[model samples]
Target: MTSRTLLRLAMAGAVVAGSLTALSVPAQAGNAPKTVPVRLLALNDFHGNLEPPTGSSGRMVDENGNTVNAGGAVYVAAHMKALRDANTIEVAQGDLIGASPLISAAFHDEPSVDFLGKIGVQVSAVGNHEFDEGYAELRRIMFGGCHPVDGCSPAGPWKGAKYDYVGANVLFKNPGEKTDVTQSLSANPQVKTLLSDWGVPALPPVSIKWMNGVPIGFIGLVTQTTPNIVTAEGIKDLKFVDEVKAANVASKILKLFGVRAQVVLVHEGDQVTPNQSPDACSAIPGAGNRIATQVDPEIDMVLSGHSHQAYLCRVKDPAGQDRLYSQGGSFGRVITQVDMQVDTKTRDIVRSSVVADNHVVTRDVDPDSDTVTFMDFWRDKISAVANKPVGRISADITNVGTATGESPLGDLIADGQLAATKTGGNAQIALMNPGGVRAPLTYLTSPASEGDGVVTYGEAFTVQPFNNLMQAVTLTGAQLKTLLEQQFPGGPNNQPFAKILQPSANLSYTYSRSAAWGSKISNIKIDGVPVTDTQSIRVAANNFLVGGGDAFAAFKEGTDVWSGPLDIDAFVAYLGQNNPIAPPATTRITAVD
Candidate 1:
């Protein structure tokens, strides 16, 4: 028998023996209590905010409707310590890294991983951002090694993560399947053989922790829509299965191992109503609810991320059992504390006894000294590159969208991309994915202290942290129109919701909110002239969009692709050329009722 099979058999036998012992020694007069209390301290979508986030990202609304500053690695540490006990198990749903601020992103997010390890994160589900740099880079992060390109940082050689990253839904593509592999492992025969092993998951599917002699199992799953959102080149060799199916399968395996208390750490969540109490459910309709309700009844609870909303809810499982479902807000702004009692005899959680709450990582608490020192070390190392003034902004260019789904910051970024590619690719227009605009660029002086209106490299880096390369492609006006149409739901690509693309200053279009999907976009213009369907035009966008990310498959039909500088480099250069830039008009895209 295989080693895995042997291990399963051994565990089954042990469970059987334990059951017999329990039956024989029942009804003792002074035996210990039958149940043990366990605490789970959970957070998700941290995104490496070592320092307190600035502007709206750093603050959360309280139950009293007051905005309060929250979230710093130090404060998060403090809160975790204050709330945890001997029976506590700290865990995360996903997005522990990627799209981070300069302090952590500068070193390929090693500092963030180190912080999570130091704070005792035992296991985490892999987020879509974990694959931002591709699966190979993620593997390097998990297994420990210096970045092949950047080498070791001043802190010393990396020791990898102390925690386990589990992803039951991530699987390797079969041989002979089409892929967009940037670095293929196909040439290595041994590696290929290993990948072909039967029923092998890309990452560990489940992690089991024994507490008070009862095993609690955690099954990890990323969103099945991961491929549509992340860069195709990075995850080209992986296939994401349905979240519900993967969770059920993993739960069955955990059951075979005699694990009865199971929790799903899924990297998908729903948006709760704005200004709702952090601890209130009030969840809007989304995939998180579906997964919570549809997963195997054996799964006891589900913690989620990716949507970056804070909520503590009790969703009904397939068997009509109310199970705790919660998500912590992104950027360490919130923590979900779950308390439950597990029955020692059955190794199962008491569903009715579970209690969960979302706590804001408020700044009022004394920060953890160790975390402060850790943040300082990384800050000092990146100060030279991060603190330099890149440009100036006359006012705040926030990513908060208007009614038409356009934002001032998105306009600025699209304009910058267009300028960068105008001469080289002869580009007439540019478009940017709204999701890529991570943060707002405020005119006020930041913690970097570059002075009011002065934007530092670090501030700019926080706004566009992905470092995607810019590319200009040739497309027919007809194709461009189709691209805009794809932004809404129910096209050939079947977008789940509207994701309006930010347009360059020279391009403008109008769409009807009540019109059919293919017929929504109208009045397409470039340079005050209506675009002819047959006319060829050069468009600029990040490589991620050109690779058909965000369901904009029409971009893949472009020709004459001309690569340019990194998106950050282009934005920085544009800011320098246009000093004291004001927020652009948000009238580029018009919507009609």
Candidate 2:
């Protein structure tokens, strides 16, 4: 017999022997069938943190109840290398690039994608932030190319991500009506053609990897509410479908390909109970839990992100079988390790043999030398821009919200937006979404030693990183009141949570916490004058809010929209003008019990 034929017969005999043992028949010595052991190291919401994150973003509470500084690309690479074997696969749940630190964002997140590829991230789901620059930009990142506008600064001839980005739910909009492509992508005819491919997903829905002759399928899904949170212009030609439906369909497709072991990498996640250990599964109510319980039974595991919480869960599937569901914390603070056994004959995971744990990426270990070199290269490239002093702060203006949901940093951003648009757009007031304020402006000097109270351009960029364009729109007093009402849950717009907008100093309003949704808001005033329902008002805000993002639907009712400078540029100009800026009071939105 040929050698290959002999090997096949031996494998068949082993399977037969294993089957006989299951039926209570004794198996011959040394003829027992073996299962392939696979290891998965999963990360989520990395947000291009090539260096160790600062403040609370870089810290994690350990099992011992001690807070330890954690997370950096170098340490992540080291931990991954130490835990990986020949049968291992590294994956990310999503938010790997967008809303990144200045070093990564300045280069359009190319460095972060490059780092992910170098560390062998075989696959990742597309997070909503992946659409921050629009689908055309994401396509460029995936397929490799120079930036259309920036043209590959700091590094020439950029190569795209080495990993596959999958998003089953991200589908092209129907082309029956023409959709205008973003100006950044107008030069790329390929993207226009791709967007016209109706009924097709914007990205690959499933990624299949082979380990030890067993094919494992990964289905990726983003949150259905992505449109409400992301900039509307970037995703005008795309729609996000239900996660459960997409997962099941992808699972069926994998099955047709003779793949039985399946996993879902979704960008929707739930939070665990406060103060719980990293592996605790006391999950709070969220969409991710619903998805975990509803996905197809053939799917063996669900790895999730977007909410950026760390938790390990074993939710019961429809078949009453338990499956692993997990999320690693954001900013690389945690890494989830999943180990499972796959039956070679059935090509299915032994669900009972699955074990998962969340490991804190503490800085105690030695950094990976290769990743350090890579980080240094980018740091050098971005230093000149990053270290330049843009403003000064008398004290830390943090993004932490108060009892009324207003944040000091949010107030500062609103003031800046108003300043930028007041003259050009005839704007009277500005409102800032709390979510847009990413980080705090600290008065202390940074590692670069730029001097206390001196805020660098990098620090300011980190605070407002999305680069949304400022806009002024005319709204009647009645519509402005409706806008304020939409901040609460159960309001006309049905927002999931209370999103109190940070108002410029010229605006103030009071809300009753115990009142009915629409009735909660009252005492609205602008510039010390009570607003009348019939009065016309010109309000300033970023394009995101006026475009109805974050469920603020009332902002869409504005007329005579006037676009201004980028939000970041406005903020920088405000900082430069208001040297040694003090933290704004968080008293703009008053809450009554």
Q: Cα RMSDs of all predictions? A: 5.4, 7.9
lDDT of 2 by residue, 4-85 (tens): 2101212323214312111112333466466888999999999988878877777888767678999999999999888889
Q: Which candidate wins on TM-score?
A: 1
Candidate 1 similarity to native, TM-score: 0.92
Q: TM per model? A: 0.92, 0.90
Once fitted onto the true fold, the runs of candidate 1 whose alpha carbons sit more than 4 angstroms away are 1-30, 175-199
lDDT of 1 by residue, 447-514 (tens): 77789999999999999999899999999999999999999998889798899999999999999999
Residue pairs in clash, model 2 = 144-160
lDDT of 2 at 585: 81
lDDT of 1 at 292: 90
